[model samples]
Target: MTSDLDTLFSDAFERANNTTKKFAPDVQLRLYAYYKQATKGDNFSYNNEDNLKNAFKFNAWIQLKGMDENEAKENYIKLVNSILK
Candidate 1:
């Protein structure tokens, strides 16, 4: 991504972080997976946690599977746009 696009994506991401909109569980999981894949490739391992919240987060992150960073970023940007709209 170019610097301008990167800036846009970053701003969108920040907006997403600040949004108070309530998303469905699947939507939230998708957003989390996209953000994780975009920022940190597919090289992360979720430590098994006893907490339900942590478990769900880990599963969400793992669901991204083989998604590429650019694709993830694009999806994340799209999701943010949809939410903001």
Candidate 2:
């Protein structure tokens, strides 16, 4: 059985994904980072693509290194709620 947090996280993710509003780059980065941290934890690896956008994304995600998955999910949900407001 999935935990309540996991269910809530999935709901928040669905809400975020279905939203049509445009967000600022920084906000987008935060969302991306939180989602990645929540899902992937510290097991991160990326190809050396040399793409600036990917580099920025990697940096954003790596900055959340060592964050607990549950905490990341909570942060992601909060951020999405704030954005939807």
What's the CA error at residue 48 for candidate 2, in Å?
Answer: 1.3
Candidate 1: C-alpha lDDT: 0.82
For candidate 2, lDDT tens digit of each residue in 1-85?
9999999999999988898998899999999999999999998988897699999999999999999999999999999999897
**TM-scores, each model vs. reference:** 0.82, 0.95
Q: Show model 1 residue runs off by greater than 4 Å.
A: none
Residue 84's lDDT within candidate 1 is: 88
Give me the candidate number with maximum TM-score.
2
**How high is the lDDT of residue 15 in model 2?**
89
For model 2, the local distance difference test gives 0.94
Measured with C-alpha atoms, the lDDT of residue 34 in candidate 2 is: 95
